[model samples]
Target chain A: MSASVSPDWIAVDWGTTNLRAFAMQGGTVVDQAQSDQGMGGLTTDGFEPALRALISPWIAAGNLPVIACGMVGSRQGWVEAAYRAVPCTPLDTVLTRAPASGGLAVHVVSGLSQAAPPDVMRGEETQIAGFLQLNPGWDGVICLPGTHTKWAHLSAGEVVSFQTVMTGELFALLGQSSVLRHSLDPDGWHDAAFAEAVGDTMAHPERLAARLFGLRAGQLLQSTDGAIARARLSGLLIGSELAATKAYWLGQNLAILGTGAQARAYRDALALQGAHAIPADTDRATLAGLTAARRLLREAT
Target chain B: MSASVSPDWIAVDWGTTNLRAFAMQGGTVVDQAQSDQGMGGLTTDGFEPALRALISPWIAAGNLPVIACGMVGSRQGWVEAAYRAVPCTPLDTVLTRAPASGGLAVHVVSGLSQAAPPDVMRGEETQIAGFLQLNPGWDGVICLPGTHTKWAHLSAGEVVSFQTVMTGELFALLGQSSVLRHSLDPDGWHDAAFAEAVGDTMAHPERLAARLFGLRAGQLLQSTDGAIARARLSGLLIGSELAATKAYWLGQNLAILGTGAQARAYRDALALQGAHAIPADTDRATLAGLTAARRLLREAT
Candidate 1:
């Protein structure tokens, strides 16, 4: 197939399990495409082919700068993009640009990491950079809820400090794979149970282990609906996260960057605590981040 | 395939994934056989076939009593063996006898369930009943650690109360399926790291979410050994469980009824907390429980 559009730049967010590319003519998005050919699905050599396949139609006559984010930059991904330690500007952070091996100029944006306690994030940093680019100089907390939900503190236009919670992953595993799966209704949800569980867990998190089993017991004994079980399970995990991250969310300017139901869940969770979180589009944030990174590359040349 | 050996009575412990039958001429186990035809792998009508396949020779001259326990009694199992409510004697608990089918006397032991802050245990109850039989009049707490680890309090031969934690399942899902899989050596383990994680989590149970992510961060930034990561993962999970169940373990005469490396890990974790836990064989517990229940059936008849 011939090139669909003559691309000036390419915006790619290659995560562990997903590869998304937005072809740009000038500085605007002209065409976009994605594939399941993520870093986790490819070896060291598979990254280039996977990328080319997704954006093959976007290939221009000249070398097109491809600004990529997410796990595609990890040591286990295409090219090893070392993380820039925190207390650094998310946008100004060092970018690991892989040399043009073919017709593509690949720049893998560096992720961010924390010292002392030790924490790291790969693709989320780019999203943060994009969020910062759009919001500019807006300081406080930005809660990015996803598989490894990130809470970043931004000030002086930099990620001051951040934390991550495995809430989404835990929910997926417990809901679908664990014994809790028996009692959970994957398609059903009860908001009241969710709010109650959030409040209860946040109050007494020491009972986490006990309460998790309660979901099953309640289903067997009290004839509790699976919807309640699913909601409570989600609430308990997210609630516990909120309890631990009280330092980050309490009395702060909060905005949640997520897409679809997950973002809504986080927004609802925050509302339960009397904190109204402004919702932002995650895909838009990624596109914006990639666009900004490509601009940085242009200026550098 | 012919009968390996003739049998008198059969001792069966049919779990979710495995079926083991001890052909007993008397109280002594004369021959032992097992199959992968656990309840989870069979349907209601398939149970009889599965049993006969495991112990075809043990059919005997007459209808030999086959006492079974565990998730084999679950609603989804062969026959719906209802759960006996708690605050009852573990050994003297009710046994649901399935009707004579295919010339086999099959009796499925009832699992225990707790009310108020509900909780349930299917297989562990049998293990507890067995533990109680051998350690007659022995009071205090017995911790049976597995996929869903159970902690039961015994007083005056009655299982006063119990709680379950999904620690093993959580560890398995996180290590094998979650993002932490990257930083983990699935086959590796370290004692010191495990102990340290146990102590840390136990001391600060509130930091559970934060500490969980630390496992991944430590691996990436600190070049942490996978063994340490594995041990720490186990420690963090088990430690948090202990912290929640502190009411049951602290200053309590505790015995860990488990087997293999996981049991040993529990022993080590307890030892770190200035508590020396006595280890008991899980198989022996199941066998003894079934034998005791079978004898009770005979006396009642």
Candidate 2:
């Protein structure tokens, strides 16, 4: 597929820990590749080299147009794509030009930022744009579950408001680094424990800090299994998040943009609360968002 | 202070990170010394050597009595000093004996445990015993601030119930290991920011996970100072704790058993809520608790 396809353009999702590039022939993907040289571990000058290393085979000819999104445009990334203030559409037509070599024309998509509540998003904005493009005229809460989970309220094709929660990050830190690490089995899961803990924290969200230490104590006193402890930990963190974001998900048309076990956990949690959330694949949303950005760039030019 | 004193009985406070010993001449501290041989890094056979290294000078003759408290008595320490159930005094008159060398008879103080809520404490029980001994017949809530901050309610001479929060551990992980580390100043302190954040989370404790990501976002969008961010993180964590344990602190005679900046922070946070928490020295409490344990051992023998 790589040798047979002479890509017209490239769709790049360059986030903190990964760099995925898709060779595009018009509206379809011809070939794809990914690398670990994401914005996180690279220096200012390393972006161009990283991109060339991944997509150089597809860029056989000169003057290849490239559309990039996520942290690649962050302040610490290859180039700083300025943040567009929200209460507007997720995508901006005016793409930020990044200095490139090997005859590559790199245009980075801008991130979205909220002023009052002091929230910001880089990679998730593209995913939101893609979700909106895939399901046009959609106006509801779109939840993007990841390391930094985002919940955005959409109205009239615009992001009216949104909030970011560090649930995934908290789970990782607590399960891996905190005293709870000793009690949690990394690969274990218990459905009943998860549901019970979710219900417990949802009802008494203020008791989060108090409840956390119980996981460790449970192991010590009752010999609670690592699987039960793991599930309970996940439930406690997610439950607190759900309780906080009740204004966004309660009685609203919701779609969660993720495809992994984490996404399933969110769905299961919401289901326990009697809310059914439509699942959307994150990769599809990202590609759709980048495609929408590609069209916007073409229209502006 | 070290060479002049030949101690009658030694009081040892061995926790997860530090080992401190006090040379006691019948209820009074003659000389005190400390080492970095905490229980966290020691093997089963290492506890005796660690303890002897620091107090070998004081133990000129064989058969010196030692009363030790904290993690040194846990299942992972020199020996397991079984946890005493609640509705009982913090320290047990019947102490666990660790295998000692050099003609030493080492007695370990028993920790307190709660069955319903599933809580456990090691060293803090000793501090509570000391507080009870010093303040005689004290009935109220005792707050011990550290890695695992404990809040215990006392009625008559028994611990009615207690709760533990990993507020200090959370602060360390979020500030030093999480993404928030980039925006936090290790030594920075902002009194107003701390107070404001404490109030914010106290009123809305469920929003902890949602509010945490804002620290990183605050740094990105607003250039929030490291000091202010650090203080806010502390406020957020502590405020959530206060919210969860409102049952223990509200309208109760409260005393905070700590002397460090962390103890003062708890005091100031409570002060903001118009609740005054009397400050107590932790070292004094430890010594007093150990002395009490010594008396218990004498009576038992």
Q: Can you list each candidate's DockQ?
A: 0.73, 0.86
Tens-digit per-residue lDDT, B1-301, candidate 2? 5566667889999998899998899889988889999999999989998998888877866557899999998899989999999989888779998998656889998898999899999999999999998899889999999999999999998899999999999999999988899999999999999999999999999888788888888999999999999999999999999999999999999999999789999999998988898889998888999999999889988
Worst 10 residues of 1 chain A by lDDT: A91-100
Model 2, residue A184: what's the lDDT? 96
- Cα-based lDDT for every prediction: 0.84, 0.92
Tens digits of per-residue lDDT for model 1 on B1-301? 2366466788888899998988886667888888899888887888888888877776645667788888888889877777777798775535687655766778888888889769888878778878888888888999998888899998987888999898988899999988788889979889899999999878877788877888889988998998899999999888988888989999999999988889888889888999888889888888787888887777877
Candidate number with greatest TM-score: 2
What candidate 2 gets wrong by more than 4 Å, as runs, is B1-4
lDDT of 2 at A45: 86
Clashes of each: 1, 1
Q: Which candidate is the best by lDDT?
A: 2
Q: What DockQ does predicted model 1 obtain?
A: 0.73
TM-score of each: 0.95, 0.97
